[model samples]
Target: MEKKKINVAISGLNNVDSPGPGIPVIRALRESKLYDVTIIGLSYDSYEPGLYMEGMTDITYQIPFPSAGQEALLNRLSYIQQHYPIQVLIPNFDAELFNFIKLADRLKKEMGIHTFLPTVEQFEERHKANLPEWGRKYNIAVPRSQMIHSVYEIANLHHSYTYPLVIKGKYYEAGIAYNHDQAVGHFNKISAKWGLPIIVQEFLKGTEVNVTAIGDGKGNMIGAVPMRKQVITDKGKAWAGITLEDSTLLDFAAHLFKETHWKGPCELEMIRTAEGKLYIIELNPRFPAWVYLAVGAGQNHPEAIVSMALGETVTPFTTYESGKMFIRYSWDLICDLKSFEVISTRGELKL
Candidate 1:
């Protein structure tokens, strides 16, 4: 007998204008017809853009975080469970995972809701500055980086490294500095506004490539797609990307799961230097926002994620349209309009 569709809840829908990675994941799952999907938003606002998935999901519920910390997240999850009766919870953001990790075991043990995720230790390495350490441990080339716990630390080590270094906030995005003064200037401002240690890195000039994948915890590769950023926004989401098939890069991705026992979807950023060598830049344990392209190219990563969570075997993905580019139409166009002021309010501007 065919099993009834399982209920799945996707959390962390914070905006509507530009949907996040989870949006595509949910959409893919809905298309797959493999599960009874529920869309969940964690903000108290009750109007997350992800609620747009209401058309696709079996149910839509918004459980606002009740406090300023992890407790608030747990409270919301509890509310979601009682109200929606979802059997699986897929968190889309780092903050959501941080909360889910606290009660992952409890959620599974007490409520029978499986939270598919890496171990807390693995999650820590993936989201924080510690990821480069994994690359080093596996002999993966990583750019020179120094962890800065405070802005003052930058001043002390400014002389140790050359200019064009990167100033990265521990919990925020990074910025490039062409000289010691520039590094310090950006470091001071970011630290004052964003807080904590920043990673000072030697910026590698190269093409940035991102590889997205799904792994089965036990060293088995389920799905992978290698793509390069053809165009990127200042905020770092790839506005356009060209797909490629490189087993060598896939090997590096395989190493990560082999070493960390990672399960679920992950994206690794790599920089190909002028010398043609690729260096691992960072790893995101969650779905890459651009995953929609992979799906469009015939790699259904989100469905693979669901299969893994359900203890089903998945085939390796060997399909991708090499060298094809996809531009995020809305965001890229909006960026152009805002930056160039080329698009007039009344009509499209002529160049």
Candidate 2:
């Protein structure tokens, strides 16, 4: 009997000093024992390395960014479905998840591109600006954060919050501002790119830890892996990390899923202070760049995500080996101009 091959599409392949989850997600899928997989790389930029990586993506297509609106993205995917049917789409960007979540039903019914994503409400509640309230409801501790619409709001922050506060953009960028000037600087810069209501969070001096996990949307946690950043880039992204044996962290992630009934992939950014209190910082709606670490630790989260999207019953993954680690590095892949021109001109490249 011929094994059935499934087509899976993944996005967020911009792997530079700052990485994307697309390439790692594809790698996890290809490692699956349950299915023969054909990887379809969906990228926003032609220069994204995953599109040109030699053997990884069997086919590649450039789609409009979420800023282009759901209609444009749907049109692009609809066109792709005509040529090659896509069974599942695992979006890897937090900025892009809203559009995908909105179109999950349209894609599944009209185009048969099934996606496992959180509901719109679930996505909204997990935003950095809303994290405090969400945590209050879920019984998780979150740093005090206030949404500021103007840069002037930074000057008076000292009255309510102390110095060395954390400045955050709604969609991206987080920095510790030691003074009012730095706070305004981050507010201006991040707001210029991502737009705001900028968020100013109370700084908690703590060890940073993160959990990459997936949920069944019925309060069931399929897979969970906790890791602490051993090395960090200037951007505060993890460059090297190791899995930890932290039952508290695992329980924290499970509580989030149970309270929200979260569906699909997510990353829980946390802070553990001197007193051993864990504070929920940010909830990313999609997989993180370090997601491959979960695969190496024995969870295969991305593969399980695809299986769930296809309506297959996946037992919850209760245990994964500890002491696993990941070190991220960049390499230049040599690619000819022809492949670039093909995707640039036609918006897709097929092998």
Candidate 3:
């Protein structure tokens, strides 16, 4: 049988120590039996490793950051589509999801670009600022949290929160502050990077677990896989993780999908307390760095998502092999000066 060839474009290609999901998603797609792939790496920075990594992408192009507004992004994507027809675009960054969700319809209508993403309402409801309220509405346990704009706000935090709490940026970065001084420092540093309104959540004592899953946008969870971090890096990334057998976690994820009708790939960050209670920590509206573990556990969610985006009727994945383990590693790639200069000057590299 001749396998159908599809050109799939993906973003969030910064496969650094704190990696993104692009590379891993690409790997899973490349292993697919449904289609042969022309992996298109859409990157924000010229030096994003996935753009230059061998076997990572057949072609790569630089695109504007999400904050550049939707029209600018549309123009750039239209230009890319003029040359390489992108069948599906899988954007993998938290900060960029808003723009993607907003533009999904336009892209499909104007440029034939397809994407599977959560609706704007579902996306906004999961923000750190509104999480506590959302948790209550969904009948889920969420760590008590507050959003603060000024560092001075932390001074009076002791009234509501303890000295040791978790300080989180609006889009990224989570730091544990053991004291007021640490809290102030994290607040300022994170605020500087991700802008105002850092999240201060009561530090819940528990074993952190994660679930990487995809939703069908129809109150159906397409696939869900649970994992436990066996080894973590200093940055708190899972350097090594193993798939777990946890029906409760899967049931919770299904409940979230049903309640929100969550449409697209999402990683639900969860914590299991000592008394066997589960608390939803954070909700990431895209694939996690450890998404490949889901693939290894017998569900290739990325491939399934791409299929769903391309208008294929996909059945929900109800089962998977448990006890699979994923160990992450880093390697250096040697590249020529011309390759770097081409991407830097022309904003693209094709080979």
Report the lDDT tens digits of candidate 3 across residue range 38-84.
98899889778888888879999999888899999999999999989
* C-alpha TM-score for every candidate: 0.84, 0.97, 0.97
Query: Which regions of candidate 1 fall more than 4 Å away from where they truly are?
Result: 1-4, 15-19, 41-47, 52-59, 64-71, 331-351
Best by lDDT: 3
**Model 3 segments more than 4 A misplaced:** none
Candidates ranked by lDDT: 3, 2, 1
The whole-model lDDT of each prediction reads 0.68, 0.90, 0.91
* Error in Å for residue 146 of model 2: 0.5
The true-versus-predicted C-alpha distance at residue 345 of model 3, in Å, is 0.5
lDDT at position 154, candidate 3: 92
Count backbone clashes in candidate 2.
Answer: 0
RMSD over all Cα atoms, model 1: 7.6
For model 3, what is the error of residue 3's alpha carbon versus the real structure, in angstroms, after optimal superposition?
2.1
